[model samples]
Target: MMQHCNKMLHHYIQQSHSNVTIKEIIPGKLQGRIASPTSKSYAQRALAAALLVPESAHPAGWSELRRMGLCNDTSAALDAIQRLGASVRYGDNRDTYYIEGGFLRQAPAELHIGESGLSARLFTPIAAQSPTPITITGHGSILRRPVAASMVAPLRRLGATVTDGANGCLPLTVSGPLRGGTVEVDGSLSSQFITGLLMASPLSEAETRLLVRQPRSLPYLAMTLEVLRTFGIEVTHAPDYTEFVIPGRQQYRPTVCSIEGDWSGASCLLVGGAIASELRGAGIIVENLNPRSLQADRAIITALERAGAILASSGHLWTVGRPATLRSFEFDATDCPDLFPALVALAAFCSGTTVLRGTNRLTHKESDRAATLATEFAKLGVEIDLSTPDTMAIRGISTSDGSLTVRDPRLDSHNDHRIAMATAVAALRADRPVTITHAEAVEKSYPHFWDDLDTLYTA
Candidate 1:
């Protein structure tokens, strides 16, 4: 099985048939709109929460999730939930996942999370609820990222003995019927661990008060809270997002829920549209995004506006037109670290220098995002200075003539979905066709990304 999974990753990497070579984005009107994929983050969170619901709450309504993207991450989340003893089925529409709630009878030998960092971290505490010792592991790039002291420390605090395979990474062994009580989790590393704790706390033998010191990605935590509330699990947190108090032994009411369009994935499309609009004098329309979503990447609109793109939203459809003159802007990405790559792509065509903060958060991703973005964009002649660890100053060049100053360069995606997508978007204004290797990495988040990019073109 391990060999087979490795073969699959190799197949995805060597899929040059899927490599996208962009010479230019034709100057034309974008015809049909791209309905964004379902939020993988939301789907995973919902599935985790659903696993904690009692068996009596059978036949919960989960809508539009099973069909939205089917990326490896979301698929891993589904598989993880199943291992935890939830019976999941697809509706006739083939989009909604109907999950029958229950707890595990016996722990699986190993929970394969499949390169999804969220699934590995978020499900660890969930799996710890079992009396049986379980080994949590994953495949691909996730193996290199740390499980962090934040995760292991708190599990230990909750009465679980946690052990990691050297240097605090994957293949972690956790044993617990976690008797939750007041625990302090250092949230500066990543908020997903806290989210895991929150989702698993309600099932603990005692009330859980989670005190977080300096939480990052606050919006993602807010997103977790919103999903918890939808399933009738309440978590009370402070205004600054420092503390969360969860009442123990609370039941997760079986929910009838549909996932909203993903702002994270949609932000890539939205930025692509903004850059494409510059070439074609067209107002690109993107569907299925809520203007009021709590997602941090939803701030892409604000970034566009700052860069002088004409932008507006009517319900779910958002329109962005290129500005006559693109200007450099400053953005603090502390809460929205995922947007760094897309923002880097957008800033490449903006004039002068664009400064993006929160570079500190990029190190622990699938790849070191800051270094990867800087390396890949430099191939396209964009100068990125990361002298200060916490900030990145991108010196943008004028591509107003719809031609990149740099010659055609072969770019590598470093096996990151966002890097591949961001580089593709940046190629829109390039003087020559850009060739990208490992382009199929988008399957981790957006499986049909190439299909969506193909649709944006009109003869």
Candidate 2:
């Protein structure tokens, strides 16, 4: 089984060698309707939940989720599941994945998470449920990230022997059948830690009481609960999202679940529409966008409105157009840090200076996002100042008439997907064609991002 997982890992490695470069985007009126991809965030969560419950017991249609195309992160979780004794098979549909779970027996020697923050963080605690010693590791940008003592501290408190690697990154070995107990998790760094514990708590030997401190990304926790409920797992928590209670020895009943559209990825498309609408009279209509999605990036709408973009929504369909006048606005992105890039892109087109708060969380992502955004946008002649540790001010360059000061510049993605997508969106209003290197990085979340952008532009 480990050998099979190694093969899968090699396949992914071979696939990543292909690189793509984006030529300068034509500034114009963009028009078209495109549905965002199923949320990898949601899909990864559901896949984790499914691993805890066997297929025979799950609800009908649950197998359909297996048929969907797997993202790099989702693929990692699935491969890890197989290594942990579960059998994954394809249905007659050939696309649907049917996982016969509950077989967690011989824990593999190692589990590899490839550039998936969610997979690495969320799967670690869950994998500890097996008494066998297993090491958790990952690839690329994930290696540079600090696993931090906080991530393993809660598990250690719960009776798991965890040893971090020399660099304190991956290859952390855990020996446990995590015996749940009262534990405190520092939630400031990431909510993924809390999410991992919540997913695995029900299977613990004792009821679990998890107290979280200063939890950010609360929406992601809400989404975790939603997915847990879908799989017949119950957890009690406060409205403030500070604490959670889970019954011991609880069973997870699997059910059919579908991954929803991703607002994080859609924010890029919407911003592109807003910028393009300014150039061409045509507006962009985005489909599969859930107005009530638990994603933090849904706040993009607020940022757009604040920047004076005209938005109209009916059900799941949303349209964005340039406002008669765009102005700088102040936004606090502390709760939704993923919106920083898209907000920055929109801010570049506005007439005045825009202030975006919540720079603290940017350093731990795929890249030093805050620094990367500032450096990359500077090439386009936009000035971004990180005046304080947690605030970024974007001084928009525009003529007195409020038209964007577009210029021909080449930007680098720094191997960050959001940065690549954000740079492309900002290009919509550029004075000349903008070239973005390492544009293929967008595949980390949105594989069809360039395709969708081309669709909207050519339509």
Candidate 3:
């Protein structure tokens, strides 16, 4: 039988002509304005909904998917949907995309997740809900990424039988009628598992109550609650998220939900401004942002504030402006791991030294992010020393030459959306252009990321 498209895959390159790279300089004064992209978290939730709701599962219904913002991660989420069962068609008008969603008649013998850690983790539970056996796998560097066996043990206990090549590694096989009851997962590993179980719980024979072993990322669970509400799946939970009560049966309403713009993606834009002080002062504004969001990346504002960046949040709109003197400060990234890259960029431009903690979660991303950041930043005369496995100290430096140098122009994102966006932002501030080898990796989160950057970078 054919395996999931995780190992030994192929992508036929379409664009034959090469692109150009230049020594670009982000003026010391650059503007701090760019529309935030769509939340990949929202996109993943929507894909799961489209698959679960029998009525909306079809290629033609995909046009119902609209853009709240630029979505590279959502693009990968849609790709996984299509690869699994649904067929999606983009309308000719360039404004509409169609989803042919429906439960797989026979479990797709193999479910391939192309470089999406969220897709791989969340879909495992969803696939286990299906009638037949399904094997899940992911491409690129995810093969070696760790999975919390502690997280999977519950799903196995509740019914769904599973198998994998290594210690809870990818190529996860699930066959089940998830006998959902009580499940416990560690929030520190990855919240996507919690989201997967939550998505699969409504259809389970029994209600599922989750007990977070050590709650780390509460914001992610909050985002899950918001998405579940959007689908009309009412979930009742205690304030502490220590418990969850999911009704056995659910009716998913076809939603005209407008996904909120991503604070995660916007963090990079804000940090870019913090690095290039020229963009501050006036005429740089970001609108339509929620001051109160369940996204941990919202802490980017706090990090910027700690580093001497100006921030003003008015209801749904927020703005980040440059400060006269940026200072170095230590930060704990336990909750907001995704912001590490953006924070690193800002940290590099600050005076003195900044030490960022919580590197444990950095391994399973699109690439070995800590090493990637250190290696790339090294080319620009910035000093990043990883003394411990879980801590990194960055010594800031001032850019003397107009072009901030990057040694490896051939750097690849290894298909991590955050990496792609972060590298693009670094390019803006660097004296030299950054030609990310796998530039297409942005599809995992913000598909139109380059387009959005083009608007501001060329302005």
Candidate 4:
């Protein structure tokens, strides 16, 4: 059998050359059942944890992960672990991964994380656990994002030597055997590096105390802690998530972990269902989601409820039904910024105006998400006002017939995954077909997005 890592790399190369043109959506034409993609967020974290497992914990030294998401981000995580001295094998089905966990006896010269932001941040600290000098770098939009304050400074405070590229961007060279102690990190930007610290601290020589300032995305921290627990590592944090306490000199227990479905990708399908389902037609059914998942994007259910989309659940399966009309709703996305693109697409089909808060969290994503959302949505005839730095007000154009009048225009994804998915969902109500450039951007987190969307069309 071909190695899963090589297969994933091949998929990435193929996706780089693909594009998609979404035709006009016919009302009552979309109805189907599809499983949500595995959560890349969880999969990547789990992969990182797997690398720290000592051979003594599991005689086989292998951590078996089932139902792992093979998206580009997760692929980067897998590749990083292998380069760092782990062995990976996939089941015939390709969804089960057996990773022999232990760092390589020799350090790699450099770690290339592709365009995954999470990989760069999460692995930087994990990489710092080693004493050798290693350079962490990425390509495309990630090279343009600022990581100095969020990643570099925190590592420095923890006793690691980090050198950043121009403008505090990627190509970061770091050397460390990170010393553990009380350190303050600005959490206003992202929760990813904080997670990295939490994962790395246990291996340090002394206990670690994290003083987090203005922490955002608290749910992700919870998820990180949960992943740590699964790997037999312990972390304690305050109720408000302002501080974290990790005992050092701890070793990871290699074990099996199952990745959960991705709500971030499923949100688009649910919104598409709400827009395409007729009054009496059966809506879309998305399976494999856990209602109690700590993943932040699960808040998509709240937005759908506020928009008056018909929702029902039966165990792991949730179905979205059509409402007589989608009502404009307000949502605070400060803690769940990934939902912004899907929420924007939903807002374009709701009557009146929909206000979404937390535009401030959008600047450093795969694209400048706030500006990208505004620019692309405008081509589809939706007006998004970003006059306020922290808020986005969307003026929707739904008619009395519950249909949207959108133009047939060319859109660009800015090589951002969420932006590509958002535009495709918004195009469902267009009067004419919409062509999206860099449509393959969805491969970052949901490689099967277009295929899944097609299933609904053909159903």
Model number with the top lDDT: 4
For model 1, state the Cα shift of residue 283 in Å: 2.3
CA lDDT of every candidate? 0.79, 0.78, 0.68, 0.84
Question: Which candidate leads the pack in TM-score?
Answer: 4
When sorted by lDDT, best at the front, the candidate numbers are 4, 1, 2, 3
What does the lDDT come to for candidate 2? 0.78
Q: Identify the runs in model 1 with alpha carbons over 4 angstroms from their true place.
A: 1-31, 58-68, 278-280, 399-402
Cα lDDT tens digits for candidate 2, 1-459: 111121111011122455444444555556778887668888888778877775455463233464255667767888887787667777686546776566375578888888988888888898788788878888888888886456777889998889887666877888788888899888887898789899988989899999989999999999999999887888999998899999978877756655678888899889877776644355788888889988888899998888878889999899988766678999999888888999998888787789999899888899999999988888777899997779999998765544345443767788889998898777666666666777668878888777677666641
Candidate 1 Cα deviation (angstroms), residue 6: 31
Give per-residue CA lDDT, model 3, range 128-178, as digits (tens).
876788888876666677653544688788788877658767877887878
Across 48-159, the per-residue lDDT of candidate 4 in tens digits comes to 8888887666567789899997998899999999998788899888999998777755589899999988898899998887788889988888889986457877788888
Tens-place lDDT per residue, model 1, 158-251, is 8887876767788898878889888898888788998889899898889899999999999899999998998888789899999999988888
Whose TM-score is higher: candidate 1's or candidate 2's? 1
Collision pairs in model 2: 24-434, 29-280, 58-254, 62-256, 66-97, 67-95, 67-96, 67-97, 406-431
> For model 1, how big is the CA root-mean-square deviation?
4.9
Name every residue pair that clashes in candidate 1.
Answer: 404-431
Poorest 10 consecutive residues of model 1 by lDDT? 1-10
Determine the C-alpha RMSD for candidate 3 after optimal superposition of all C-alphas. 6.7
Error of 2 at 203 (Å): 0.8
